[model samples]
Target: MDIIVTIFSTIIDQLQKPTLAFLIGGMLLASLGSKLEVPEPVYKFIVMLLLLKVGLGAGISVRDANLTELLVPAAGAAIVGVLIVLLGSRTLARWKGVSKIDGLATAGLFGAVSASTLAAGMAVLDDENIAYEGFIGALYPFMDIAALVTAIVMAKVSVARRASNAEIAADGTMAMNAAPKTEPAQIEGLEKGLVKTILVDTFRSPAISALLIGLAIGIFAAPDSVYDSFYEPLFRGLLSILMLIMGMEAWARLSELRKVAHAYILYGIAAPLVHGMLGFGVGLIAHHLTGFSAGGVVLLSIMAASSSDISGPPTMRGALPEANPSAYVGTSTGLGTPVAILSIPLFMALAAAFIG
Candidate 1:
């Protein structure tokens, strides 16, 4: 018991960032190409923890939520994030000359929420006795469901397109043995890699499994066994692994930097601006609708600020290995967080002073 508490404390401490310093350290490590190898089980554990944390936190968040008043904004932000995935995928599909599936998979990643950022918000708010992170967590499942559906639909469409298109040319791949080698070896390679990397990994994620379990428990009214002691140890261990995977993934991002083009710029600059504005809007609306103080109002930004898009490059590197997502995640985490840290207090103060 003492060990569990001690370990939990250490994990949270290790995961947090004081400022740009964590990013700088990450960048420096990237530049050095230091082989910081995390164990395979550790990676899986991280995914479990990451998803579990996301699920558990989200579960706890919406437990007593006032669905009537809060559901709208929660649904709105979640929906908007999905819409952005569709729009962003369109842009990428057009530019990258990839299948709709590929575009969807890529865009879906960006559309997904970054729990690390939200975790940071939770940390900040908890420190101050504020109550807004819960609202953001409550909205997260919508983001996951949207991403899953987008990926599934796009994957099916993309696969069908591959089967139908003459250009697909999967000559040697599961051919009818007389299709005259329709797809060349190279094209087959691309096709095989893409299918395995995007569709399979997305579908087979353990985090998703755990989340569904939590959702079932949420809806079905589980006994204390399912909620309390049942997954407690798993949850804490998962939390540590999640942060560690984040760190490991961060290392991969630094390794592959050159391939990323202007996307890095969008993540660092455009993302934060969009996040702050939307978060502030959400906060303001939340305030008007409910009587939450300014501090509570702007807590939305903390969740909005740190993005999975910032982590997009790093994330891609893990699966694709063809793209270095670090520049996006590292640079944006560096830029977005500090600004958010500074902006949050100000917004909360102003909201409280003027609005209250």
Candidate 2:
């Protein structure tokens, strides 16, 4: 009972922070049919600045981090990413009225990291005076790339298998006789440049590119003065606007989500909590092994809970063209992102409760 009270109190306190308050306020405005809307170009610029800030900070930290400290948690993050998608494949993919393609696409998004959400998590932790490793931001690409590549590969394989089965059912004798000749070619074609495509697309995506550029500049050049004087001060104000835009967007996507199967609505609501706990569990193991900090664990949970709002959708659209955008995009932007943001304090509270 005491534990529950502590968790609830932490959540309440965290929600009152400006970063979160702006989010809730935006939702309220949108719900009331307020005409407030941030221009797309301005929103994109805010995201770029935020990602660069995160990357620059992480890069500076990475300059001094021990090799082992970075590698172990990175491996853990990659594993969590793959596990989230696989877990969803078994559950969401099998739900009645949910197509396999749609489910996997949704899973891929959930598994992928959210740049805005990561920034938000960092902001909240900063506000609460929680100390975390700087290299935590560096782990984003490993998890993001792994989850995306895994999901797209799985979806392509599933589609290929279904196609082969269909051919056999249509003409069993011909398909069986030609199976040895045709199957290998089909497999080879699926494997050919599929990963390359996903990789190129992901790296070139606006958010990831901004982050990578920031990381590069931080590592290879001396940006400390500018970073501290310029980016640092601007971070919170920009994040508040970003959160407001996200809140309005989340509310706007609700109608699209409502059009999809009810299972998706449920999944969107529940997956963040479940996936976050999974991440927290992995972070615990890392902490015990490598002394991964309490705040790092909470951030990892935030990454897990967040669904991809920036990169995942376009990558999924290109990779799995047949999948319905309304399902994955709506569920993610509409429900998953909000739940993930709201759950930040819960994970932070859990980390304090357990790690302390």
Candidate with the greatest TM-score versus the true structure = 2
Badly placed stretches (over 4 Å) of model 1 are 1-27, 30-35, 50-54, 90-104, 133-135, 151-204, 215-248, 263-269, 290-356
Candidate 2: tens digits of C-alpha lDDT, residues 237-273: 9999999999999999988977789999999999999
Model 2 per-residue lDDT at 347: 98
Name the regions of candidate 2 deviating beyond 4 angstroms.
Answer: none
Model 1 lDDT-worst window of ten: 320-329
lDDT of model 2 at position 170: 85
TM-score for model 1?
0.58
TM-score of each: 0.58, 0.98
CA lDDT for candidate 1: 0.50
- Minimum summed lDDT over a 10-residue window in model 2 is located at 175-184
